[model samples]
Target: MYSPALQPLFQSLLSTLADLNLAYDRDREKLSESMKDANLRTRALEKLKQQHHERREPYLQQLAILQDRIQRGWH
Candidate 1:
């Protein structure tokens, strides 16, 4: 049993520590979620770049072929 004179001080201290713990947990969760979102975005961007490169490679080859044909025709 707590002494009546010390009960209020203990209660206030307990409540303050509980609030601080809750806020700290919330901040930690938010940071974890943000990091996960950033990782996903980075992966998506890398995939998009890879797809663009694959799509453009054929076009570049065709342009080169056309340029060679034009040069040979002129000579």
Candidate 2:
């Protein structure tokens, strides 16, 4: 029941609000996707770190043996 002059202004406001809502939803979806990507990267990095530590165990054992030999004057 708005005045004729005010009808266009009300319609314009409604259109603007609808556009803002759509933009907000799109941004929310993008943020969720980004969080998923970050979690995947974090899991990958953790796996690599575990593998690196596992690979170093043998080298460490060798180094310890060499250290013992040097201390005993066997090399």
Candidate 3:
């Protein structure tokens, strides 16, 4: 088990990650359900890609930092 002090932080991080995953899933579903027109579908998917990247990068960075910190703590 993780240290008592770190468990809450771990849970919070997991919750954030779960939320991000759900948002991404919804965005993907929207992309799949977008207009049948080829050009419109392409545009919609690209827009979603850009938005997802913008949101995910920072979250992934933070997650990586947290992982690094945990690994360092373990040593």
Candidate 4:
């Protein structure tokens, strides 16, 4: 049982925790999406490198950027 005065505080804390959970889920989803895209791009770059014997600098750079963004919690 909680006192009346403390009820609001408890409610506010619960709300804050809920919001944090939602934000965490959103960030996780974004990270997953970024990783998937990076994997796809990497695969494509590998294919291009194999088929055309070209450098993969640009794709590698993009993949690095995506990884950095994910690490930095850009979402």
Best by lDDT: 3
Q: Per-residue lDDT for 1-75 in model 3, tens only? A: 345676677678778778877998898787778677878888888888788788777767776776787778842
TM-score-wise, the better of 3 and 4 is 3
Assess candidate 1 and give its lDDT: 0.57
Q: Candidate 2, TM-score vs. the true structure?
A: 0.48
Q: What local lDDT does model 3 show for residue 37? A: 82
TM-score preference between candidates 2 and 4, better one: 2
Ranking by TM-score: 3, 2, 1, 4
lDDT score for candidate 4 against the true structure: 0.54
Q: Candidate 4 on 1-75: residue-level lDDT in tens?
A: 334554564465556556655765565555555655777757655554464323334444554665565567654
Q: Which candidate order results from sorting by lDDT in descending order?
A: 3, 2, 1, 4
Misplaced by over 4 Å in model 2 are 1-36
What's the TM-score of each model vs. the native?
A: 0.46, 0.48, 0.72, 0.46
Q: Residues 1-36, candidate 1: write the lDDT tens digits.
A: 433554455455556556655765565555556656
Error of 1 at 27 (Å): 32
Tell me the deviation in Å of residue 65 in model 4.
42
Compose the digit string of candidate 2's lDDT tens values, residues 7-72: 454465556556655765565555555656777757655665566556555555655664565567
Clashing pairs in 2: none
